[model samples]
Target: MWRVWLLLVTLLGAAGAQEGKVGPQKKPSPQNAPSGAPPGAKNPCESPVLDVTPKPPPTAVLDRESASNLARSMSRLLAHQQERSAQDRAGALAPSAAALAKKVIDENNGIHAVGVGLPQINLGLLHFRHHVVIFQNNNTAYLEHYWKALALSWNHTSGVWVPPFLECNPHSTEIWLHGFAIALTVEKQRAVAGIFRPLRLDQCDSMMAKLFGGPHRCDEETTKCVSEEGRGFRRAGYRCECRDGFYNPGAPPSWRGFPGEIVELDPNDVHRCTACPEQCNTCNSAGKCGVQRDPLVRGALLATQAACMLITVMMAAIVFKQRKCKTIASGMWTILETILLGTFLLYSTVVVRFFEPSVEQCLVEPWFRELGFVVCYGAIILKLYRHLIEFRTRKAHRWVVKDVDLLKYLLAMVVAVLCYLAAFTASSLNFIREQYKLVRTEETSSGQLFLACKPLWWDYVTEAGEMLILVFGIHLSYASRNAFTQFQERRFLCAAICVEAIVSGVFYVLRAFYVTTLHPDYMYLAYFVRSQLTSTVVILLIFTPKLWYQHKQVRSLAQEFSCRLPVDAFRAGEAGALTADGDVAELNLADMNPEDIRAELKRLYTQLEVLRNKTLRADNPHISKRRGGRKVAHRRFSLQKKGSREKVRRLVSLP
Candidate 1:
């Protein structure tokens, strides 16, 4: 124990005697060497004093930075620990003490140094090379020897960094300053007090100041300095490791902040770890929440459309074969085909929805979807309206509106829709918006997107327009309710309109909710159902009945009379058979044969003189006595004539 103290104190004395410095001298003085009892001895300390001069000025700044006591704090800690352990062991167990000492030295990586008097500090491990500056405010006022210098007195037995300076015993103020460099004694190992280093920035912290020269800095007050995970350097970094679910994005490495070094940690920041994107709990990077396109449903939509188109084609072919047959009794066969064409367009709209939204898809989808609806529904209304006109007219007039004329009405509706879409498109009223929320993360959510025809500001206008179309369809259905057709087309059309209304209502109510909560796959399913169901209803209820009736060779779907004309009535149009009776013929009100009704009307013309006399007498109040009798006769004749004429005209002008 005495020898251990003697060896360390002798080396420390040699450093000051040789250069009046704090650290070990560069050259050992053989004359100053005390007679050692050991055979093999050599100096392990580097230069006794160090020189460090600041150049240019500290210019570094940080988002969060301030002066700190890392150097003094860490150095005091190491010195206290080492000195205590040294006294505890009394230098008896060399290997164990050496191991303990090395472990303690390695604990402080970003080593800093400062003397009791120096105002400034230096960076790096507390080596003899760095010097503290105690002089007044001047960069070059550093007289290297006047400032506190770190002395490394290498105890050969314990291969570890010891305290900067130590005093063997208590001393007065006079001897304290001189003995501050190093203390020597020829006594057994005993407890020694470390020279007090002021809270002034130590060498490591000053090194930090030098490193903090740019536009970035670390907050040491809130920071923590610790050993780097795998390194032997003292004080690896100043940081607080993020908890389980959080992460520090773009944070500086452990080495950079405490000691001012750069390593990988996001963007090299010095703040506490921020939470990762909410989607990623178990991992790093953005989470997996994203829009998942409903491909399966979209594929089904395409297939359904293709099948419908095929069915539409076949129906068109079958309907074409029955073109001239009034029994299939849709308005004009050509107009009905035009309706089929419209249905084909509607079905095609389903296929177009198979792709994701983009400029082309956005534009094309609305165009196809709305235009198809306009054409199909418009054609239906026009067909009904043409028949409706006949009933809407006064008794004296007949409406034989041409098929092409009815088409013009349909074309006008289509043109109106096209203009509406064009105006919206030109104004760029459409934009992609989140259509459905696919996932919900605490911080951020993900959803599917789509191009709305009109943004929120004007979307109601579009909705209103759509509502009006359905209202008009309902109105048309009602107005034509009493206008009888051979094939109960009114009922089926009303059914189709009802279906569309239901779909529209449901879509309107659920749209807002599903847009935020439904999955994309379900969204596609809703789209397919809404698009196809109306068309399906129209096809199955209206057209399918026609197809079935036409297949069965039935001429008229009208329930009232047998479809065939009586042979007598058929011959009535061929000869003067219809006019054989110059007298008014009794009318069979149930007769659907055109010639039968015409024959009756022609016979009524032959009684025009008699019918006129009765009508005049009945309408004249002056002849009150016989007016009742004449009115009864006139009423009977007038009803017969009107009914006969209506039947004849309707049957003859059916196309």
Candidate 2:
């Protein structure tokens, strides 16, 4: 029996040595064996705890009862032996596995170990699989399966928590290797071992369901998440690798990277990833591009449209009022008002153009904006010059014909300039439409059509021309500031021009920079603000005064016509009665003909002259006696003297 026992031990030892040559071997200590598993029974193929390989058929036959008894005895013996070996192997691996788990946990910052899921299991000849539950500092848990764990090492680069024993495919599915796993430095030698694969979407869903007690949708597969299944793994997880046009909207607002940069699937989150808006390729929680204009821009555009409409109405009223004032020839002023109205219309169009982008509107809006600005300013400058002429000549009629002829020339020149600019603009826009139709970035959802244009040199050229004219107008107004007939008018005109020029210049500069940095929506808002400000300032300066003056004139006319003549005053023959200081009080001339008015005024003047003569006679009666020494001489001299005095006053007051 002793000899047989010695031979069995020797054969078992030799078999273990032979198996060790295929891959690295781990010798489990008997003292450290687990309580349940027998000492050398952890890996049956490695140690041959029962040597259960089938013998060459059955040797001999016997009675049924005898054969059954023998089979039962052999089974008991094998079970007892296997149990002892498993205990031994468990004891041997326990300390090492514990140390290894600790080392891994320590290497991975400060994650806590939530106990081992399964003790290390040598699936094949040499390779072992370790199941460890790790809790991240954030309270999130991960079930990590370590393959070829005996030789595990921390990979400092790549930031992946890959075991050192695995030779990871960097360019392939992260930490994966193809072909049969050959013995590398005595590690696992299985057909496909030492490979790590993430859980598949379904597996992750199952795992998440198990953890949180609810069904969970897994993150979709992405390019960065590509990986092959190894022995028992699939590629999927909570790691953020969002699909194209799909973003993790639940990510932190401060996270400005591409959509899936740092997707968090904490318990608080509803969905890990979401699709961007139809018009967006990538977006934030608000479904807006990173550089997109805010909602305030739309509000501002609406406001601009409202202001343009209101100003348009006011301008139209002013023009109508000026037309009604037939006493004042408002031909040039009418042209100016018309130009302002056109400017407001252009502003309205520009505002709407941004609200909805159409190729046709884009083609014409730029021309409209530029031409309206030039012509509007040109008309205003012309009005200023015309006013200066009237002031210098001091005769409104002197420049009437000249102004009419000059206005026609001005209109013709404006038309010519507009035609030139329109041609240039058309050519440039056509080129843009033909040549640059597609967006440069493949990820951008905006169509190939150009939404906006950089100010070309020719664009600046036209702007510079406009600026030169505006500056010239400013210079002329400043130079003839004192020459203006009304200082108030000059002040308002200069102020409006200065405001428009400054505001427009600033807007241009800001828009140039904003267009380059921000999306077109923001630039649209800036344009709206600029257009409204320019039109408003112009209207306030030019049209407001005219509207106010017309209002006052209308009120005066209404008051004049509404006045009533008392019957007592009419009976006293005071049709145009003179007050205490020889001033004629207003009389109600309602329904009176021009002839009746002329006759009444003449009679009143005769009465006033007779009263004046009576007063003079009372004051200096001696002069009447001495003058010419005759009644005819005195009367003729007094009449001549009064006529000479009226002529002197008229000549002195001539400006």
Candidate 3:
């Protein structure tokens, strides 16, 4: 093996030395000369073209030309047959087998066959191919001289020019593979199949063990890698520098490494490196790469968050103050306030996701969002239930009970929220994968990695939930359409729900096909947070102010009752009136709630009706003819006038 390698190297050296000498120049013919040149002048083409100011050797490739020239030269060194003749055996060796294999595999780095060849040379074949094979053939001298002549023409210094091909006999079986149909002997056949074949396989295994760190590895097979790793081959011009699947994540701008070393190829794992900026896919270490949100998209997301937060705080304050005004916190109406507050908070958080929505955020956001809607809509359903109950009782002329049964409603709301949460969880919301997109601008260039959620279909839960609420609210409104003024509270609730449903439904339909033009958060804000915007308006313009006014009316009614009949004088008036004396008695109406006040009004109306009937009977013509009747008529008129004046005072004092 040593002798064969030494002989090949010595031949290559002699060939290089001979090719370096300049050959005799050719004189140009008169007709072949340039039109402006003198006759018998040497053509400029006679001399080799040279660059006066040649650039330095490029550290990295800028184009395909240099690489292409290198490939062509390498191809010539490892001879590829374009056409095979009938004399050429199917499995045949080329001239200078040992030198050819060494030059093709070692110098070219395992790139053997190229350009749509019938058979691709496996890299593992390098192990067996490099073995020294001694052939007793007459064409041995011719093969050696042919290789020597071809090597002479190769340029070793500049390494940019194409190499010339060497011609060979087509019928030379003595120089081909061990087996041949014509002139090859059986001795050569036995040497190849018996001695060379097994030796080559063993050598191939050994080489694979050295190159891939394992004997079982095949050069054609790909390897596994992590999230930041990859594997590739050299058939595509990658010489273990940065393989095809690998990328350079440049160092941070603060790195003090060599100027061009900000990002360098990994020595171990081809794809593993650290150069990308925080929250970025790839960068030049000088700056981060992030996708900039469009101005309109950014503004909308921020505005929605700010607005929702403000509204949430305002609603909570109003609800708190309303409760402070002697209003029951554990009542059906309080549920609506709770719903408004929950929705506001949910919306505010939803808008924040537009900024940097990660996998964790996407996974958990829907749960809170669905829970908020459930609470709000569930409260509406309970309110409708309470309203219907009251409406039925009042129509039947039965005493209407105003008990809120707050615990029952709250339990029901919790159950509904849990059900929504369960449904959302069952839907299996998740972040599928991250997409690294390159961002380029006049100011900077970078790459951004965006995490998009999977199964975007679950967002319809909100729409379905809201639609159900609206349906029930509309039903309740219809049920109470002809309700008396005493049940006017239903009207405000009906109007509020209608407005909320319409606004939300319109936005929901719009968002069905509306894609974010700049950032994903824009769609998130429009879809998730916009519903709360409608809820806020309903609370501000409809719910809160109306409830505040009702509270004020109740306070005014209580104040007027206290002023008319003081607690200190109530006992004296009651005792005197019962003794049948001519003194008018003020009623004992101390500490009366709104419900008690309504009862008092009903009693007053009954008394006024009785008094009005007696006065009408006393004014009849038959009664006036009798002297006693005329006296009765005067007495009744006096009582009627007093009752009318009392009724007028009470009516004037009502809220």
- Which model scores highest in lDDT? 1
Taking every candidate in turn, the Cα RMSD to the unseen true structure, in Å, is 28.0, 29.0, 25.8
Sliding window of 10 residues with minimal summed lDDT for model 2 = 135-144
C-alpha lDDT score of every prediction, in listed order: 0.46, 0.45, 0.42
As for TM-score, the candidate ahead, 2 or 3, is 2
Encode model 3's per-residue lDDT on 1-655: one tens digit a residue. 2233234534421211111122222333334544322122244223211222122223213212323333343344334432544124223333333334344335433222111000112110111232332322111222332333222322232222111111121222111111000011121121011100101112122321222222321122222211111221111111112222223345443533221111123233233333344554444434445454566866766686677678677766766675634233424346756667666755645564655555566557766666666666556556656667655633322224343574476667678777766766554532222342212122221234334554345578666866887887788878866654332556666776787778778876775544322345456656555655556555654455556666676667667867866776557645675546443244456555667776665466568978996886675654444432333323533346557888999999999
User: How many pairs of residues in model 1 come into backbone collision?
Assistant: 25
Off by over 4 Å in 3: 1-290, 294-333, 393-410, 426-451, 485-487, 516-518, 524-529, 547-655
In TM-score terms, which candidate is top?
Answer: 2
For 1-655, candidate 2 gives per-residue lDDT tens digits of 2232223323322212222222222334444333322232432122211111111112112112222232233223333334345346434443443444344334432221212211122211222233332211111100112322212221111112222111221112222111111111112111111222222222233322321223323344431232222322222323334566666655675643332212333545433456766765555554554334456867767775877777677767756665634222343456656567557755765555655444455556656766676567766676667667655543322232365655686678668877886787677667777884322211124422224443456657766776787788898687667663432566666777787778877876775555555455655666666766777767767666665655565555445534554434543346444455322343445555655655564465569978996786675644444433233323333346557988999999999
Q: In model 2, which regions exceed 4 Å deviation?
A: 1-244, 247-300, 303-307, 310-314, 326-333, 356-362, 393-403, 437-451, 484-488, 519-521, 553-568, 576-655
Residue 441, model 1, lDDT: 29
